[model samples]
Each structure stands twice: as C-alpha cells, then as structure tokens.
Target: MGGNELPLQRIEPVSVSGRGLPRWLRRTSGPVALVLLWHILSVTGVLPSEVLAGPSTVLSSAATLIETGELQEAMWVSLSRALTGLAIGGSIGVTLAVIAGLFRLGEDLVDATMQMMRTVPNVALIPLLIIWFGIGEAPKIALIALGTAFPLYLNVYAGIRNVDQSLIEVGRTLGLSRLAMIVNVVLPGALPSALVGLRYSLGIAWLALVFGEQINATAGIGYLMANAREFFQTDVIVVCLVVYALLGLGVDFTVRTLEKVFLSWRPAFNGT
Candidate 1:
C-alpha cells in the first residue's frame, strides 16, 4: 500500500422510497389517502350521498360555483374579513404582550384584564356582540379579532419573557440602549415564540371567521353553506368545508416556511 493511500470503502446510496416520497408528496399522502378512501366508499355505496357528499360530487359543485363566480365572491369576502380581523387582533396582541413582558407596571395593569377576558369563550360573546354591533359586519369582525388576540398575547408574552438573560446582559455590557437591546437582542431571541403565536392566532382567526359568518352574513362561505344546508345541498356544504380545510392548510404551510427561513440561524435539534 502507498503510505499516503487509505483503503477505499464502498458506500451505498440510501433509498428515500422507503420514506414514501419527497417532502411535499409525503406531507400530502394522508390527505390523498383519505380522499381516495372517501371516493371508494362513495362508489361502493357504503356512504350515502344524503349523509355525506363524496369528493367528486363536491369537486363538481365547487366547479359549478367557480364558473358562476359565486365561490370567488364569497371567498374574497371571507378572506378580506379574516385578514382584516387578524391584522387588528395581531397588532393589539403584540403591543400588549410587549408592554406587559417588558414592564412590571404594564403587566399589573393589562395582563390580568387580558387573562380574565381570555378565559371567556369568544363564541359565548356572540349574542352580546349581535346586540351591541347589531348583526352587522362589525360584530363578525369583532368576534374574529377577539378569537385571534388571546393566543398571540399568551405566546408573545411567553416568548419575550423567555429570552435569555445572558443575551440581555451581553447587550447591556456592549452598551446597547434600551431600544437597541429590544430591537436586536430581545426581539430576535423572542421571534420563534412570536411566530408560533402568529400561527396559532391565524388558526383562531379562521375558526372565528367560520363562526362569525354563520351568524348573519349576506355573503361568504358560511352563508353559502348555511343556505345549502336548508335546501339539503350536501355537495355545496362539503365544498365550503373543503375550502376551509384547504385555507387552514395553506396558512399553516406558509407559517412553517417562514419558520424555516427565519430560524435558519439556529442549530437543529432544539438548538443544542
């Protein structure tokens, strides 16, 4: 053997097929399987159309609605309402959480009131909302805001408070001003938790939208579904439900992608 040469070892390429597919397809497998099973059951007459509409029937209904622009209009309304409410709620939540997390006096004044309101179910306030806001868009938007705020508040507060003392000390030692320390060290350190809160708040916003639109909306998916229910249009109802599920999944995927991008600086496996 040459003094500089080491023995060669053969290495086999690992098969990813055993894990089923690439990341995207793997993530979709469960929903695809469930859809296939649903189709099978529907075709086999195991599931009655009256009780539940199959994916095919719902797809057809959705296509019809889309062609007529009904679904598009309804979806736009719901999306606008949801986004508006989320913006309002998220801003309030982050502001309050930052205040309370950073200062003892702020916590004493604001945190307890928030905690009390958080314990009260947002849905339960619907009757009062209807009475106060008079079954208009205001009540619906308010409900969504209410639903979205609590989770963000809880998560953001926790995140800010949980920021490493060592980092804060280092920032101070480096002669960072209070605002500078918050912007650089505190906010960056608290970001993961804040993102988590954002994801959770988004979910709550969707749920709130669903409930809100069901109340007295002239348009929106919930209104369409409610109208369909009265006439026994199972496929349309299913379409509405499918839309909600897809929206939720899309939002979750967006947030997950954001997390991966923003948290790239952290080490993998609990940052160990």
Candidate 2:
C-alpha cells in the first residue's frame, strides 16, 4: 500500500475588529475604571481623603507640587541618580557576563561571587555603605548599582551560553575568528535576553533608589515622600507613588520599543 499523508488542519488568522473597543480605549479602560471607582468611593466616604487620597485629590496635589517646582526638582534628582547607577552597573554587568560566559576561568572566578552577592538584600548594605562612603550620594549610587547589576549579569550570561550550538558550528566552519564569531553570532542572538535583563535591572534600580533615598536623602522623590509621611499628607504621598509608577512604565515601554526595533529580523509573537 502507498503511504498516505494526513491532511493539514486549516487555521484562521486572528481578528481584531468588533472584538472590543478601539485599541487605545481598550488599553486605557482599566485605569479609567479604577479612577472612577476611586472617585466614587472617596465621594461616598468609603475611603477617607486624608488616609487614602482619591485620584482627584492626588491630581490636585501633583498640580500644587508642580507649581512649587518641588516635584520637578525631586524628579531631576531621582532620575539623575537612577541613570548614573544604571550606566555604571549595567556596564559592569554586561562586561562581566561576557567574560564569564565566554571563558571558563572568568566564570569560576566571578559568577559565583556575583550569585552570592545578589542573594543578599541590597538594602542591608546601605548602613555599611553609609559607614564606608558617608551619608552622601556615593552610598545611594552604590546601592543602586548593586541592585542594577545582578539581573543583567544573569540574563546576559544565560543568553550568551544559550546561543544555538549550530550557529557557533557554522561560524567555525566559515573560519570566523573568535572575536568575529562572538560579535556576529553570539551577541546578536543574546540581545533579547540582555534586553530582558535591562528591563528587570531598571525596575530594581528604582526600588533600590527608593530605599537608598529614604535612608538619608536631602533631596529626591523619596525625600518628598518621607516629608509627606511626616505630615500624613496622603495626597502628596500618592502623587509620589504615581510618579514612580509612571517612570517605571515609561522605562519598560522604552526598552520594549527598542527591542522591537532591534529584533525586527526575528519573528516571534508580539501581541498584535
């Protein structure tokens, strides 16, 4: 008997039309609903304005802060510190990940130590950092750097190590030098993972900054929050929290956009 091939099943392409509201509205609906609910609750006295300020109260607080230039100054300080730490720590992470991933000796010497370091809570080092570097910008930046390093290192290392063996074989067969092979074959393949690390690291950087600034900050968002806490200014505190949320979301969006642009050659399901 002749061999028979099974028939392939038909698959329908995904559709967006009539599924829901327009994309922009769908994206924003959740937050809008939450805000409306919050306003309703606040109006009904289900939530106290002083204890847990509603969206309107928080918005008003933000406007007042902005008018006073307090929010703007605090934002600048916080952003500067975060960016500085990100640059330094991210550089170190990528460099070390590359070395450790590429060389057994480097892995043996560095990767274990970093793994141990990451296990320790970054905030625990704040006191030590203060003692060593004084209650200055140094400790804050250092804490942020520490927080920023580990995720990037782990992701980058994994990405490098996980590059397709067949691609490496192809590089060797083509008589590519070690440097050329890594640059052309390994790094490109590893970029997606590295970007993942970047997003995680950025998140941790903000968290670390929160702790770092709260410790002894003369000026920053954390300082503003601390001051608001002292007076029980729930509205101001909520404003700071909102700003942090927006900042984190902004950075994540930026990284995702960059990933899409750079990874155009790779076909993967990005939500349509």
Give the top-scoring candidate (lDDT).
2
Candidate 2 runs further than 4 Å off: 1-18
TM-score of each: 0.91, 0.92
In candidate 2, how many Å is residue 27 off? 1.8
- lDDT (CA) per prediction: 0.90, 0.92
CA lDDT, candidate 1, residue 109: 91
Per-residue lDDT tens digits for candidate 2, residues 1-272, read 45797778876667533465778898899999999999999999999887799888888899999999999999999999998999999999999999999999999999999898889998889889999999989999999999998999999999999999999999999999999999999999999999999999999999998999986899999999999999999999989988888888998999999999999999887476
Q: What TM-score would you give candidate 2 relative to the actual structure?
A: 0.92
Candidate 1 lDDT tens digits, 172-218 = 99999999999999988889998999999889988999899988899
Candidate 1 Cα deviation (angstroms), residue 190? 1.0
* Local distance difference test, candidate 2: 0.92
- How much is the lDDT of residue 237 in candidate 2? 91
